[model samples]
Target: MKLSEGVEAAIHCAALLAGLAPGKTLPAAALADYHGVSASYLVKHLNRLVAAGMLASVPGPHGGYRLGRPATRISLLDIVLAVEGPEPAFRCGEIRQRGPGALEPEAYRKPCGINVAMLRAEQAWRGALRAARLADVIAGYEAEADPRALAFGCAFLERHQRPGSPLSNPE
Candidate 1:
C-alpha cells in the first residue's frame, strides 16, 4: 500500500520532536522548513497526529507542538494509523462471489489461499511497523548515520532545545 507523502513528513517531524527537551516544542512551520515542505499542507498531517494523541498542541509565546508521551511509547504503526486511518491496506470485496463461474456450494464459501496469504502479509507488515518505535529507529540511526547528518541533527536540536526542557538529558 502506498502511503501519502505526509506520512513520511509526519514520521520525520515526530522523530525530530522525540529528541527535543521535555516540554520544548517546535511549530509546524519549523517542521515544514526542516523538510522543505509547505506548512499549510504539512499541518494537516500534524493535526491528525494531535487528534490521535501522539502530539499535543501548546498555546502562547512558549507554545508549539510536543510529543504527548515518550518516543518509546509511540510506534510507527500509531503514526501511520493516525495519518492514514485504521483502514486495512488490502480490501477484500469477495470478487469470488460476483463472477459467473463463482463457487456455489455449502462447502465452497471459504476464503481462498491467495486471499489468506495476502491478509497474512498485511498482518506481518503491520506487526513489524507496530514493533518499531521512533526511539528504536533513532537509536539505530545514531549508530550508523553519516557524521554530517548526525551533526546537523544535534546542532538543529541544540538550537531549538529550551532551557530547563525536560526532554534533554541532564549533563
Candidate 2:
C-alpha cells in the first residue's frame, strides 16, 4: 500500500535523532532542513511521534526534540501508525450485497474470494511492517554512511545540543 510522506519524514527524523548523543536534541526546523520538508508539517508529524512515545519535545530556550527511546525499540509500524494512524488502509463495504445482481443469503453470507484474498494480503503486509524496526533501517544506513561523517554528525549535535532540556519519560 502507498504510504504518506509523513511516514518517510518521521522515520528519517527518528533515525537522525538516533544518531545524536544521548539526551541531545534537534529543533524541528533542523529536521525539516535535513529532509527538505515543510517545518510546520514536519512538526505535526513530530508531535505524533512524541504522542506515540517515539520522540519527545523539550520546551525552553534550549528546547528541541529527541528520541524518547533507543531506535531498536521503535518499529516502522510505530512510526507509520503514529503519523497515518492504525486504521486499515482497505475497508470492506460488503458491496457483494449491493449490486444489481446481488446474491442470496447462501452465496452472500460467505465472504467473496476477492475480499478474502485482500484480507490475507493486508495481514501479510502488516506482519512485514510490524517486523521491521527503526534499528533495522539504521543498520542499513550505517552500513552505507561513512564512519567519519557519522561521527562528525553526532559530534555536531552533541556540541550544539541545548543543555537543561527536558528529558522524555519514554516508558
Candidate 3:
C-alpha cells in the first residue's frame, strides 16, 4: 500500500530526533529544511505526532520539538499512525455486493477473498512497521553512514540546536 508523504516526513523527522542528544530538540522548520519538505505542511504532521504522544512541543523562544519518550519505545507504526490515523490503508468497500453481478446477501455476510487477502496484507505490513522502532532506523543509518558525513551532521545539528532549553536538560 502507498503511504502518504506526511508519513515519510514524520518517520524521517522522528529518526532525526532519535539521533539527537537526549533532551535536545529541533524546530519543525529545521526538520523540513533538512528533509527538503514544506515547513508549513510538515508542521501539520508534526502536530499529529505531538498529539499521538510520540513527540512533545516545548513552548518558548528556545522551544521547538523533542521526543516524548525513548526512540526504542516509538515504532515506525507509531509515526505512521500519527500522520495517517488508525484507518487501514486498504479499505474494503464491499464492492462484491454492489455491482450488477452482485453476490447474494448471504455472501455479503462473509468478507470476500480479495478483502481478506488485503486485510492480511495490511496486518503483515503493520506488523513489520511495529517491529521497527525509530532507534532501529537510526542505528541502521549510523551503521551505513560515512564517518565524515556523520560528523558533519552532528556538527550541523549542534550548530542549529537551541541552547538552554529545558528540553536540553532532562529532569
lDDT of 3 by residue, 1-171 (tens): 788999999988877776667656788888888889999999999999999988888876777887777788999999998899899888888777787998678867766889889989999999999999888889998999999988977886887665425533332
How many pairs in model 1 have backbone atoms within 3 A of each other, for residues 3 or more apart or on separate chains, i.e. clashes?
Answer: 3
True lDDT of residue 70, candidate 2: 80
lDDT of 2: 0.83
lDDT of 3 at 110: 63
RMSD vs true structure, all candidates: 3.3, 2.5, 2.0
Q: In terms of TM-score, how similar is model 2 to the real structure? A: 0.86
In candidate 1, how many Å is residue 61 off?
3.0
Off by over 4 Å in 2: 104-107, 146-160, 164-171
For model 1, the stretches where C-alpha displacement exceeds 4 angstroms are 103-108, 160-171
Judge candidate 1 against the unseen true structure and give its global Cα lDDT, from 0 to 1: 0.81
lDDT score, residue 6, model 3? 95
**Candidate 1 residue pairs in backbone clash:** 21-167, 22-166, 22-167
- As for candidate 2, its clashing pairs are none
Tell me the deviation in Å of residue 166 in model 1.
7.0
lDDT of 2 by residue, 2-57 (tens): 89999999999998888765555788888887788999999999999999989988
lDDT of 1 by residue, 99-130 (tens): 77876655456776767888899899999999
User: Higher TM-score: candidate 1 or 3?
Assistant: 3
